[model samples]
Target chain A: MSSIISLKHLYKEYQLGDGSVFTALRDINLDIHEGEFSAIVGPSGSGKSTLMHMIGLLDKPSRGEIIINSRDVSTIDDNQTSTLRNSYVGFVFQQFNLLNKLTVQENILLPATYSRRNLDFDPIARSEMLMEKFGIISKKDSYPNRISGGQQQRVAVARALIMKPQLILADEPTGNLDHKTGNEIIDLFEELNKSEGITLIMVTHERELAERTRRQIRVLDGEVISDKKK
Target chain B: MKLQGVSTLFTSSFADFKRDKVRTALTSLGIMIGVLSVVLLIALGLGLKNYIQNQFESLGANLVMILPGSGFSGGRGPAGLAGGAEFDEKDVRSVEKVPNIKYVVPVYIHSSVITTADKEISGSIMGANEEIFSLINIDVQTGELWKKTDVEKKAKVAVLGNTLAQDLYGNPSDALGKTIRVGGMRIKVIGIANKIGNQERDGAAFIPYTTTFGSMNPKKTFFAIYLGIADKESVTTVKSEVEKTLLKRYDKDRFSVTEQSEILSTVDQIFGILNIFLVAIGSISLMVGGIGIMNIMYATVTERTREVGIRRALGATTRDILLQFLTESTMLSLFGGIVGLIVAWIIVLIVRNWFPVALNLFAVILAIGVSSGIGIFFGVFPAKKAADLSPMEAIRYE
Candidate 1:
């Protein structure tokens, strides 16, 4: 399979109040292929989340490169990076991050609303289809808070897929859900990966959650410890 | 950003205002008061200006006046209250002899308590020649004006204004043939003038200028000379001749020859300055309103930090976040401005009977423009703060 994203000697650093540099990720090389269901797993502060940020193009690395479609994200300006994110990346946060003001339909349409360019497909049609598949079509008019936690996560997933992005970045997507609900979310991702050739990247601290995915990349203390394809 | 995106953003921002209705009103209230005071004050100023303009227009425009001292240079001469060249009978006669000058009416003015048997009013009395009535468009409502023979004989006959006649005798016609004291001299009221809606003329009593020499003006010098031009085309020729005649008697610095339109334009210039001054005073409140918007926007930006991060992560550019907050604040101020304008318009309409208050187009434009400008000016800093937020940290924030 063709690689959708590739990283070369990636590094991330932060400056503390004492003027000392804090290295969040160091000397990392990785690639995520299309139609693959993968997980970047580690304990908290293992730089697993930081690595996700770099891959998502939500941040700029202090050193090394991130390549998507042969373009270096580090070399681009913030606005260009934004355009890249809009066209290529989709993100799901642990908290769901659904705006309280909009209805579920509007929340699902949020990504398409902020797109600087017109999308290839009709956003309403795609959103309706996604909602139908997720079985939350009846709750389309309700607010995110008015619905159950699992439904809110479903709406968030619908939002992430609205742009038909090259990859979906789920950051601790099941961290807030119960075990049963979390398993359902993972099953949904697996189905999309299998049935529609969608690339899925899940970030989690739990090893069991990581093992459930087709590929697992383990990280500890700003370094990758292992990469395994089951 | 695309127009569709902007519209959606506006909808989102407007929805934010609905969550905290009380705060929204309170935030816009500052701008409301600012626009309110500005429009109201300007209305009052315009009303007064209109009143003055109507008064001047009522008098025929084919006229000129010679004042002592350089009049209407935006500064009064050292003539001290009754300042300027004290034009007398000789100056009047010389100006009257100038070609195209129809009639030269000399005037002597004084303030006095005019009294009847049971009533007295502090009033201004104007003493002029018999031709003054026609020259100044003073139409009589009752009885007849004094003939030219009365002024030659220095007759103790006075014409009362409609309001003044009403005040002393309770009816304008009741004032005719009654004797009222002008200063210390008793004069018989010969006529009651038409109600002209001009404050100065409506309140003053008119009499023969010759009669005032002994009691009202011991110096025997006329206050001003009013010249009615025979033809409109000869006004300029007559004006220069009158100026030359006056300059021969007194220094040019001590006297001025002014046409009717020049006087009107000078009044317009004075009102322009007055309007600017009033607007400056109003701007202080508008600025305060802007600052209020800014303060609210800063709080909004801080509160929405996580929201901003989410939008950015969803591919919203920094420009989008900045524009969203700016549009919201501008909408707040514009709302305030429109509300304030409506209130001011209602007030102007109510007071229009007594005062000629006008809610003009310039005021409307200024209200909308100033409110919008204030919103943008004050909203910049807070929007910058929001745009500069790091998405990862903001989303991770508790």
Candidate 2:
């Protein structure tokens, strides 16, 4: 099967306030296959978040090529990046970045409104099914602030899946949840990977969460230290 | 995106506004006041102009006046000698012979005290020929007007205007045969003329021109001549003929003739300038309103930075971001303009009811257009700023 995502010799550098350059990621290479549930584990300032940013097409790498579904997106502008992200990738942020003002259903329907391609799924029915599956059905009309952190993250996941994107990039999606809720979120991701075959790329500091994924990579000082597949 | 999506965006924006009702109302209030001020100012200007125009129209269009000039040395009246020379009975007789000239009445005026048995009132005394009755419409409330024979014979018969009659005899009817003192001469009131509103001629006692010239002080040689044309259509021709006749009789360019319409046009020109001045004054307020909109929009950008980030993450393009902010600013201005229009209309109605002015529609439209333009022009910078925010940084913003 063709790889859903590929990165080669990726480098991301940031200029410090003192005008010295600090390398956030260096000469990184990675491939994520279809339906693969993978995690990038790292300490603070270890380049995992930077890598996730590049992978999600939210930030451009200083040097390298990134091919997602065989389309190279390394030098793309903001508009093209947004188009690609809307059509092919979905994001779940650590802060449960749901619009606090909108209800759960509205948050999920937001991506469809902005996508270049029409979303054929009935938003109401899709939201209903996702909420039912995630056991958040009763909270469909509730705002993000009214719900628990775990429920908010689940709603974020539901939003990410609404566009039927092939790739999901999650940045510490369960960092704010309790231990039980975090495990439950991971189990949901695993089930989505197994059943629906959506590739999952997550960045997390939790060793247990990283280990649960089928593939794991560890980074230190902006370079990869280990890569293993079970 | 489809139009349906745009409509959805509008609905969403409206919902958001509804969610924060107080802020929305406050923002709209700024716009409303701006619009209201512009509309009311323009309306008031128009009303004043209309009132002035109507006042001019009340003076008959075919009426013409001849003012005397002193000399033609430098188009300047000589010092110690008044600028305009005086016209005499000969000039009046010559103008009377002009073709299409219906009537020519020369007026001589002075301020004097007139007393009855119990009351004494000070007012203006005017001396005019019998033709003055035909030249100007004056309804006699009680008695007959002095005949042309009375003027020819230099008789002391007089007509009392409504105010003069009221002052001399207490009742307009009783003033008919009463005698009024004018500069030491007693003139018998033969008629009590009808009341004319707020005009210079409305409070005067009228007597024969010969009688006034004989009895009153003799140094004032100039007389104001009122020429009534036979045909309204011949007003221009009649005016020129009268001027030519007077010029021939006077044997110099010592007279100036003015048509009522010319005076009315001059008045209109003045009001037009006044309207422009008022509009300029109102524009300053509108500009302030524009700045208010810009200030509020800047605040909105800062407050909704996270919302902007969320929208960006959801795949909104920079253009979308720009449009959203622009739409918001424009909506604010449009709402303000509407509110202002309503307020202005109310003021116009009140003024129209209370005063003599007429309301016009052009000023209302101008107010609305100017206010909306202010909104769009001032809103662009903030919208661009909001649109240019870095999605990555914005999303990460706390």
Candidate 3:
């Protein structure tokens, strides 16, 4: 299978105020393939979230070659980078990250609102489809804070899928949910992967959650220690 | 961005305003006050100017005056209004002989106390010929005006101003045919002039210049010589002719001959300068208003840091974020400007009945344009700060 996103020799460093550098990601070579359900698994301070940010194009690497959907994005300007990220990738943060000011329906269509590209498909129609499919169409007009944590996660997932991105990057998507709610979210992701054949990359510190994925890339101290395909 | 996207952006941006209506209104208050003062001051200045123009136009356009010193340039003559040259019968006769010139009224003006049987009033006394009534638009409400024959005979017949008559006799018409004492002379009131709306002129009394010679004027010299021209077109010719005639008898520095329109324009020029000064004062308030908007924008940017991050993550470019905040600040300023303009318009309408104030197109345009400009000027720094935030860091900000 072709890779949806390939990161070559990625390095991320932060300069501390004390005139010292802290490396977040070091000498990373990874490829996330199409239609694969995978987890970037690590403990706290393992640089797993930073890796997800790099893949999501939310942050730039100090040194790397990033190819997203077969397009080299490392050298693009900010406007181009934003457009690429808008159309090519979807993000699901650990906190749900739903804007409380907007309704559920508005939230789902948020990605397409910022899309600068000429989209072939109608975004509103697809947002309704995602909401209907997720069984959250009844909550379309509800705000994020007014709904349950599970509902907000579904809305976030629907938002992630609305643009028809090549890759889904979820950083602890079920981190704020209760155990049963978390299981339901995992089930939702499992169904999206198996039924739609969409590329899914989840970042999780929980070992059990990582175990549910079809493949696991384990990392420690900014370096990948293992990559296993179950 | 697409049309729908732009709409969405505005909807979301304005939602912030909806949530904090009070903050928005308060933030724009500085701008509102700034715009209000500017518009109102301009309206007042315009009204005063219109009032002056109407008053001059009502007095008839062909009137000219000969004064002591430089006249409209400052002095009644070179000595100024305090102690200027006074014209006499000879000067009046010379000015009247100029072609196209009409009645030449020689005036000897003084302020003194006039006493009736039981009441006494201190006011201006205009000593002039019969033509003073028709030449200056003064109306006589009771009896008859003292005639030209009254000046020839040095008759002690007087015309009392409306307020002066009313104050002395409770009603102006009652004062008719009554005798009033002025400077040891008892003068009979032949007529009472109507209400003239001017403070000083409303409470005055008029006597023949011939009667005022020994008792008040003493030198038998006139304070000023006022001429009426037969045609508006000949006003300049009559003016120069009178000036030449006067120059032959008196030094050019000692007397001034000016058309009435020249005085009107000189007063108008003074008002123009005053308006400019008022505008400078108004602009200071506007600058302070701009700074007020900037301060609030900075706070808003800080408050919305997380939102900025989320927007960036959702594919908003740096420029998008910048434009969003910049537009918000500008909208705030424009909101103030529009409100101020409306408020000022309402005030002008209410004041129009009593005064001549008006709001012109330029003032309206300035309110909107300046407020928006202030918004943009003050908004840029905060917007730039918001746009410079890294999306990841912004999202992580508490």
Candidate 4:
């Protein structure tokens, strides 16, 4: 399969208030191929979230090259990087970061609204289809705060797919939901990756969830300790 | 950005305002008051100008007057120069000869006491010829005007003003044809001019120039000269020609010629300055309004930091964030401007009966423009702050 994302010697660092540097990711190298359903498993503060941030183009690595959709975008300007994020990458947060100000439908259509790239399909129609598929069509007019955690996450997932992004990155997408709802969300992710051939990259601490993916990469202290196919 | 995108952004921004009703109204209040003061003050100034213009128009349109003692010096005259160096018959005769000059009447003015049968009163006495009444277009209310033969004959006849006639005798008709003592001369009343509200004629009496100089006071000279031009448009030409003739006959330092147009323009200049000063005061309030918006927008930026992060993650460029916040603030101030206009209209309607209050379309447009401009000007710093936020950190903010 063709590679959708490739990272080379990536490093991330932060400066503390006392003028000392702390490394978050050290010389990390990895590749994610198209249509791959993968999971990065690690304990809290193990740099899994940092790696997701780097891959999502929401951040810049201190020293690294990142190729997204076969194009180098490690040092792109803020506008170009945002455009790439909008057109190529979609992210689901652990907190189900649906804007409370927007209704469910509006929240689902948020990505398409800010995208500079012309959408091939109508956003309203696409949002409707996704809401129907996710069983949240009845709550389409409700705000994020009014819906249940599972419903809000479903809206967020629909939002992530609005622009038909090539890659979906979830940083603990089911962390805030109950077990049943979490499994349901995983099933939705599995269906997307299997039926639609969309690449999926999820970060999780749950061993069972990580095992459910087709491939698992275990991170320990900002380094990949294991990579295994199911 | 595309039109649809901008429209969506505006809808979101407007929804935010709707969610915080009281805060939005309070934020817009500054702009409302600013625009209110501007519209009302400008309306008042224009109204006053219109009222004064109407008053000037009521007085004959073709009238021109001459003041004594130097046009350049404002007629204050040199120190120790008595009032004797005023306009005389020579100037009046020369003015009459100028083209477009229809009539010229020399006026000899003085304050005097008149003792009639049963009452004595203090009043002004104007010594002028028969042409003087027609020059000012004062209509005769009762009795006939003095004839030219009466002026040349130096007959001691008088024409009382409406109020003066009423004061002297209980009725205007009672004063006519009766002999009354004025300035120590027993003058018979010939006529009474129509009552034209409070004016020079309303409180004074008219006597022949021949009568004043020939009988009452031989030492009196013409106080001023009034020239009646045949047409109002010919005033400028007559003024210049009158000036040249008077300047050649009497030194330029001795007299000043003033057309009706000059006085009107001087009034216009004063009103113009006044309007500018009032508008500046109004602009200060508008500027304060703008600053108020800036302060609130700064607070809003702090409150919506997470939202900024969310929008950034959703593919909003820094420029989009900037424009969205900017549009919100602009709509805020523009809303205030519209409210201000409505308030000013209500106020004008309430107060219009007591005072002249004209609505100027230009001021309305300027108020709207100024409010919108203030929105953009003040909204920038906070919008920039929001746009410059780091997306990762913002999304991570609780």
Task: Kindly give the stretch of ten consecutive residues in candidate 4 chain B with the minimal lDDT sum.
Answer: B72-81
lDDT of 3 at A142: 91
State which candidate, 1 or 4, has the greater TM-score. Answer: 1
DockQ score for model 4: 0.43
Q: State every prediction's TM-score relative to the real structure.
A: 0.92, 0.84, 0.90, 0.81
After superposing candidate 1, which stretches have Cα over 4 Å from the reference? B1-3, B73-76, B79-85, B169-179, B184-186, B247-253
Give the per-residue lDDT digits (tens) of candidate 4, residues A62-169: 998998767888999999988888889888989988888889998888887777766668888888999999999999999899989999889889999988989999
What is the per-residue lDDT of model 2 for residues B47-84, given as tens digits with 9 covering 90 to 100?
A: 77766666556556488878666321224554222545
- Give the CAPRI class of candidate 4: acceptable
B164-264: candidate 1 lDDT, tens digit per residue: 99988887899999999876899999999999888778888998998999958998888778888988999989989988888887876787777878878
Q: Output the worst ten-in-a-row residue range by lDDT, candidate 2 chain B.
A: B71-80
Q: Give the winner by DockQ.
A: 3
Residue B350 Cα positional deviation in candidate 3, in Å, after optimal superposition: 3.7
Cα deviation in Å at residue B379, candidate 4? 1.1
What tens-digit string does per-residue lDDT give for candidate 3 at A1-230?
Answer: 98888999999999999999999999899998899999999998999989988888998999988987677787788999888788788888888888888899988887787888778898888889999998999999999999999999999999999889888889899899999999898999999999999889999988899999999999899999999999
Which stretches in model 3 have alpha-carbon errors above 4 Å? B4-9, B74-80, B111-124, B137-145, B155-207, B352-354
The list of candidate 4 runs beyond 4 A from truth reads: B1-3, B58-60, B68-99, B105-224, B231-237, B244-255
Error of 3 at B79 (Å): 8.4
Query: What is candidate 3's DockQ?
Result: 0.54
Of the two candidates 2 and 3, the one with more favorable lDDT, higher being better, is: 3
Report the candidate with higher TM-score, 1 versus 2. Answer: 1
Chain B TM-score by candidate, in order shown: 0.92, 0.78, 0.87, 0.71
Candidate achieving the largest TM-score: 1
- Model 4, residue A14: what's the lDDT? 93
